[model samples]
Target: DVVGLDGAWVNDFAKQGAIADLSALMTEHDYDDSQLASQVEVDGSTYMVPAVNFVYPLYTNDALLADAGVDAPPSNRTEFADAARAITEAGDAAGTAMPLSLETPSGVQNQVMSWLWASGGSMLKDGKPDLTNDGVTETIEYFDDLYQDGVFAPGAFTMKEQDMVEEFTNGRVGMMVDSLAHLTMIRESNPDLKFSISALPAEDGYDGKRGIPYASWGLGVSESSDHKEEAWKLFEFLMSEDANAELASMAKAFPGNVASVPDFVEDDELMSQAFDIYQAGYPANEFTGLPVAEDLMRQMNEQFQAMLEGDITVDDMLETTQESWSAEF
Candidate 1:
């Protein structure tokens, strides 16, 4: 049978032998996977094929920025913090939105960890937990400072991604780091909203390429499926250059096939901007393909919330999260 799943869960499925390896099938069918952005491989065996990748970019409310006297979108962390503070002080809206709810802790991956990624920082080093690294430490301090200074929108600890998106659409927040897939929904919900999408702000003086976080719609074949060849046919068709491009365009995401370029950029200005941002960075999602990825994020979310509430220090949070993640590895 055909199996639909998130790219992040591919490794776990493969490890459990729940998914069939597609390497032989792909080779027999002459399928070229070289262009795909991500391949789900376990023990050198291909397990899943990512179809579309939704990249996260910074979304800014132009009117709020202008009201706060900010001249342009921030390119680095220092400027970003200044603009956020100005927006909050101007009483226009909260500087930015953060969804930190533990119930759906993927925000730890999409929102919080994105900051670390953008700055060329990583939670893992040499494929192991390294949460206490200088970069991770600094990143945590920066966000904790923002939360303390009231720069984040209300209910951050209780908010989900949908809630954050709703706040942005309703003009209650001035900025957010979010996926391009939500572009159409935001437009349809608030046709008059004026906003722009840009690359996530990098750490100061970090001139290297930023790491843009992404999620994917991925597919695989069940190990026990009787119709393996039939499933292979469907996968081949969907991943074809033309079909891949069409799928990405409809979903407002970057094509999983690197050679397949979506057409939405030509018709939508924001999407065009998003495309530029996507090209300037590399896809980064360290948690993807890791075992117990969601559980790790949940553990981080718990400690992060505690740190924000003054119940724990940054060091304490880092130590706790590091130990927890190390156990998984």
Candidate 2:
């Protein structure tokens, strides 16, 4: 059985004929795709079910905020920077903790792009890379300044998401943005850590609107599977409402089955906020699951890393990114 692959793998797998098209199985089994919040579709065919969807939110260490005399998390980009600086001073953030943890290359890429989207732009528009959008340019400049001002931890460009999570939970980061999947682990790692989750701050004049990147892991059957019928039976059974409810409860993730949602949603403040963000968010990138898209993303990341090291100016980075995109697409 083809299973437990990243959502981005769907398109390439289908192109290689390594995974069977799930459209017929979906219909034959009376599976309703619309009930799920995210679906993996390549061209006109369904390739994977939405097994577990994840979204990122700004996580604030409430204790750190209180120590910094910050009354609340910043609601806009202008205030976000100010808050970072204030926390840095009031809490001796440079020595005690990072005012913010912008995990590099990987998380930093998403962190910046979320800003781009919040500013009403996209990396891809109309089936092509559009990294030169004004919003995108502004986001890069914003981060360039933020990083130069020492808002993020030193050596952050060398840190990954896991590293940021470790710092945040260890009381070494005043704030960080990360996925819900990390929440349970964070709580378990440090139950006494006072933290709160909120949507990413938007640029001033953005009316508090922000964009979240959504991803999911779902099931797919291998084309070479001889026991296709039996494999599907297992897949279908797991996708059932009862099974989904159980799965959601265990994983602390949203279930694909609409009927199973309340099992994880009700009385859960974090999950409820997550659902709201999900309602307002978009897929991380439209180019995802496409062959050349990964290369494009890597090139973008490399440019971003260069910007962090003062090796590339923001304008130069964007110019290079656009050239790469133009060449690729």
Candidate 3:
């Protein structure tokens, strides 16, 4: 039902008061959600709903897993590494390529943050920067290790976005992480490939808070909409179990309403596997007072890129990062 670039048509209708309600990600939960903010409250009235529950996970090659003699499914870091190492060996023996790939700067950073979150650290705390903490150190160090271990290609710093998918689909990479909706794309790429998803392996450091970054699209109704009642009705219908099931099929994503998609969930094995991780994966912005998250992401990506290129030292990143956070605070 949504058809314009950047979902602009919906926003237009919202602004015009022509559309009284909208199904958007902006207003799905009550104010109790620590990670989400309300966008529809005006003059003591509410006008939006948000429906997002799944984040992208990496898809792994089953044949590679079998060939490596690794465990069937990894539950923790030890198992994940053992599997990765085995895949590398198997690829080497078969004269194939690496088993992991993703070129997005933010994607890499998000993965790194999950390691940090799993290790119990975050970019901001109470509107302040917390990048110099121990968890961040280990996370970045781990990434550096992966980069240096030949696990990543020599030019990871220069790779393009879709290239990662191409690498995986071409069988040059055994694992690639993207949107949860990628299952459809993956199926289209290799109809018969033995692939499955697993929750991110847990960390060994600290308590391992079990965290992962979340990326989602959502629905929202406009406060200015004239069809508020109709919009609400449509919103409820779209989120209904049956409608959500259909949506899951069309969008290749989990339905926004958690309890309503039982049948769809029961029928989808990969979604089931990914949902287990979704349960443990909390938002990166757990610290309520954390400074503006997007700003920090942009800044950190720039610094991290320099650090990876050997143009900046970890200490330099630390200094700048702390300073940046301090200014923001």
Candidate 4:
């Protein structure tokens, strides 16, 4: 009864024979395979029922931005930096905290990937590391500059995702790149927190486009389960249209069932922004659906965090990561 195995873990679990195939269950329930995100499969077998979908986007505290004289969210990285600087400065004057905050490890990995994707770069070009590309290099450079200039909150190099959300919810940060789950938390905790949402900004001085980092949570039953049939029956019920819509509402996630997808795209402006990014969302895992995909990402993210902390240069980080990914791939 695993509730939420990451989508990236599906492949490794399938390879390890740890999860039962849900393909038959899907057919019996009349679940259209075509409606699912492609990450649900491994070697032509469906191993999990996707329950929640998410995308990472820039969430701004509009009150902080207005206080800093920023009229709108930045369209690109240069403006983002400028706005961050202004907000930081103003926050300083007002005895507040930093304007930008980022998560370490997993969440920071997503943030960095957005920068790469915005510049037409990917960590995996064809199931192998592409860390040495211009997009990756420049993205690291920009983050390094921001860190050195004291743009991001102090200790951001080690903060976890929940830590970042705590900072945002407490009005300590003007902007952050995070998932819809945080939005729900913020609203429930502080309904008056003035905020706006937008796509992640592009690389500094680049006009490529904004990028969204999307991921999912799915249900997987152990292959050794004596009641795999019962487990899959539960999966079917959980992923059913009404159940999915209700779950999405509670979690502030997109329903995995395509038939219930419209429930998330409401008339609200925030929902509109979310829908725009979700429609254009890209998988954070460049080698998604591959064996050890999540492990590879974790390895690279650890190295990337080191780069952010100035423990290693971008070139050295890329070279080391390339070797590790090559060995794994």
lDDT of 4 at 90: 87
Off by over 4 Å in 1: 23-32, 43-45
TM-score of each: 0.93, 0.83, 0.70, 0.79
Clashes of 4: 0
TM-score of 3: 0.70
CA lDDT, every model vs. true structure: 0.88, 0.70, 0.53, 0.70
lDDT of 2 by residue, 1-329 (tens): 75776665777888898988888887887877666655566766777776666677778888778787778877678877877776677754531122223222345345567667655567766556677778888888887777777777665656667877888888877877677889889999998988888777787877634566645567789889998889898887877788877887787876666666645667778778776666565445444455554565667877887886899888889889888778854
lDDT of 3 by residue, 43-95 (tens): 22322333543464656777777888865766556666666666776774221
Query: Per-residue error at 200 for model 4, in Å?
Result: 1.3
Where does candidate 4 clash, by residue pair? none
Task: Looking at model 2, report the run of 10 residues with the lowest lDDT sum.
Answer: 95-104
Output the lDDT of residue 211, model 4.
49
Q: Is candidate 1 or candidate 4 better by TM-score?
A: 1
Residue 118 of model 3 has an lDDT of: 51
User: Which candidate number maximizes lDDT?
Assistant: 1
Q: Whose TM-score is greatest here? A: 1
Evaluate residue 105 in candidate 2 and report its C-alpha lDDT on the 0 to 100 scale: 39
Clashes of each: 0, 0, 19, 0
Sorted on TM-score, best first, the list reads 1, 2, 4, 3
